[model samples]
Target: MKNLSSNVTERTERRKGEEEQENTEERERLENNRFEDQDETTERARCEWDFHLRTVVSSATAASDALGVIEFGPSGELLATGGIARKIRIYRFSSLVAAASDADGGGGDVALLDHASAYDYYICTPAKLSSLRWRPGAGGRIIGSGDYDGVVTEYDLERRTPVFERDEHGGRRVWSVDYSHWEGCSVMAASGSDDGTMQMWDPRCDGGECVATVRPSATKTSSVCCVEFNPFGGPLVAVGCADRKAYGYDVRKLSDPVLILDGHQKTVTYVRFLDDRTMVSSGTDGCLKLWNIDDARAVRTYKGHVNNRSFVGLSVWRKGGLLGCGSENNQVFVYDKRWGEPIWVRGFEPTGESGCERGFVSSVCWRQVGEEDECTLVAGGSDGALQVFVGTRKPS
Candidate 1:
């Protein structure tokens, strides 16, 4: 009886040990399966986000010339675009599509809408519009535009006609226009001409006269390509010149540029102030250079595009800490301010139509709504098409 009892006990102990081992193996298998599933989910999300990084909407073909500049309304409800054909078109945010996935938590799904006909915001026929900018703080009810005829026109949102028209530069083409946030009617604009000079204009005056003009003293003679006003206000402007150099000027005393930036081997096409002391410039030399205006030094140089392909447009998203650039190569690149490599490259797809490759991208802007943390990137192509991309932080 004792030997039978012992055998029974021994068998029971062996069965319990086996059961524990099986449970341990099963738990490990489940853990492994969970890890694999997580990796797959990550990869799939990445692929989807990448797909969204490309072109989202192709603006209507009937808008006439290649689109040159794009701007978003203060509420993100409207997108304004300017083209070489002397026309300005406005697209509503309601037409855009919100991406489905939540990858960045930066904001809600990216806003990418299908191609729809522009709302024909305002038409400046015979003007040859060069740039468009919506006044900040005003509910997108006021717009300012610069034209090749050296004219700056301010249009009220409700009415289709210009409330103010000023030929501040004696009919020299106006290259860029920017309004001040502190003062509504106060505006600072720049004009670049074949004569190799940059003139600043203030439209608030009774006649909207030229406030100041800057020219190369003796050694530098280059046509100004673009100009931008400082976001923090005061008498500061950044200018890009064809002479392959950028100059910073104090509108208070424009006798000479406060600082001269030298880095681009070709013409500097665009200049934007990221903040009070830091500015960014893109050039036909196929390089994007960041400068510290206070110290008057080039802090970093970004090189990716080959050859001097007319890299003309640049903008910085103050909220996102990202910079966007458009080139004549039919491509747009996004770069993180801290990193040297581009976060992503977009707009390379063929339009299935001829002459699309020659379509130079003129401008890019970021539109945000309410308290959202993220913004959508809107670009204007030379073919008079507006494209939107809805992703963040992609490998170049």
Candidate 2:
């Protein structure tokens, strides 16, 4: 009976060993799969950075004109560009891309999408445009612009006429305008201006009266350069100002800021939301900062772009975790959100050009959609030069 008991114990030990071996092999397979996935993600990010200049087109304005703002329509079908020329030129995206593709094989000649045949129409503004945003849910028919004359105007693109106009900044330049909507609120417009206040307006209100106003800076002379509503939908709005600070506020509470991002040594020129809880701000001190609105702290600082003086432009592509900004050195610098160094840089000068343009790249915008294997980037130079870059996956 003792011998029989020992044999049974040995059999049980063998079964236990087999189970352990199976579990170990399964873990190894899963670990291998995890590594493969990480590798694939790394490779895809590398390919996304391989940007090529697809086309370069100078705006119809004279050589002295500076293109201040560029915005792409929601559907990516239309592009609106405006600047010191006091005109907003609208172009068909397909026409620009097709023209560039046609010139691709012709000795890499840069095709100039001229004003005569390229743009659909140009909207003349009362003053030079400082900012432009396409109103969301407007079916690409409505657009808005903030101008140097301290006015914010919304236009109906279908009718080529102004639909709404407001001039409440007391003749100070209106630097930025943005829109926000929430569950309980109708569409509200916010404008940041040199008058040191951010004002919210509801177009539905009679006489277009200001609904609310928030003064972020303690000093009365502090100019609010940029304003952006949280794109993810909320009462949150961010403002960048000449006080060398940025503020995040819930529209519901206008008296106090929920977050104060203070680090820039110079004027904060732009602010944009990266997500519901995070945002980015640019300053004339030559850096872009990523902030956690919940914690009111900067998580990252992006450098390598020379932006010590003017508004060199700041934009973020959330899908790919990329940040794009213009440099004072007349180049476009793109950075991955995870890294401080630039991943790609492209100069604004076209082929065979003197490269003597006096201004830097003033604005940049990425096509919001079409991220399956490729994407498009539109950059506007202070010299009124518009360049389109296409990023495609590299063949394995």
Candidate 3:
């Protein structure tokens, strides 16, 4: 009877050992699988340089002239493009349909299968249009246009006529016109001209008189290539000049510049504020400069893109933390907005010289989609069409 009991105990012990080994092996297998899943997820969220060509719109203008500027509507429902052809074209969002409408009018549920679609209409300008800006809260219907004849016209698109016209530059070409977009931003439009002056005009005035003007020092009387109000909600405005210099002026004090930032070797084409204290300027010198408003000099410079003929403005998409610009060769180069490091480059090349002549990319803007890890970049081309690129943002 004792021997039988000992055999039963031995059997029980062997069975318990086998069960423990099985449990350990199962746990090990689960841990290995968990690690594999973690790695796969990390790989999926990583940022990839997979910018896809969305659509191509050729001969966007009837005149076949160079398209120099493109701006997104305040609500992203429309696009406004203008250029040397003296025409302002408006395009409605193509994805908004009965089948695509969301509760918030966002059309988020729609699938954009044919991404390069836009229905276009145009309005003629009196002179070669140099710049076009949409008024705030006009739903992209009201446009303020500046021309080479130093004329500034505010037009109501729905009305199909000019609200007012101003010749503040006085026989000089109005190189740039931009809205302040602040508390009373649209109340007055800022115009920079080849007449070596920057003037503010109130379109509502009966005569379209210049209410204010920014006068730089005796040397800065050179043609003002571009002028933009400080977007950080202030009275400061930065104006780029043909003499390879940029000056920041307080709107309250037009007699002198608050500070001057000079670093480019050639003409300064565009200047804009990334923040109240930080700004970026691009020039024909094939470089982009970052300047601190507190200092009189630029902190850093980015290069490798050329700009000789037309102004290729620097665009900063703060949400995506990106900075990029176009070249005369039609190439678009992107960089890290924070550190100014090159990321990727792309350009459109058709058959030959006929396309190349109009292929120059003069300006670019980045538009971010709603709450999505994606953005659409549009470049104004000399070919009369806008080059569109869609990019996906990778998880950091």
Q: Please name the candidate that would achieve the greatest TM-score relative to the true structure.
A: 2
- Model 1 lDDT tens row, 146-165: 78787778777777677777
Per-candidate Cα RMSD to the true structure, in Å, reads 14.1, 6.9, 13.6
**Which residue pairs does candidate 2 place in steric collision?**
none
| lDDT tens digits by residue: candidate 2, 281-301 | 999989889888889889988
Off by over 4 Å in 3: 1-49, 60-63, 95-117, 137-139, 184-186, 351-358
TM-scores of the candidates in the order shown: 0.75, 0.85, 0.78
Best by lDDT: 2
Point out the higher-scoring one by lDDT: 1 or 3: 3
Better of 1 and 2 by lDDT: 2
Q: Per model, state how many residue pairs clash.
A: 3, 0, 0
Cand. 3 Cα-lDDT: 0.72
Q: What TM-score number comes out for model 2?
A: 0.85
Candidate 3 RMSD to the real structure: 13.6
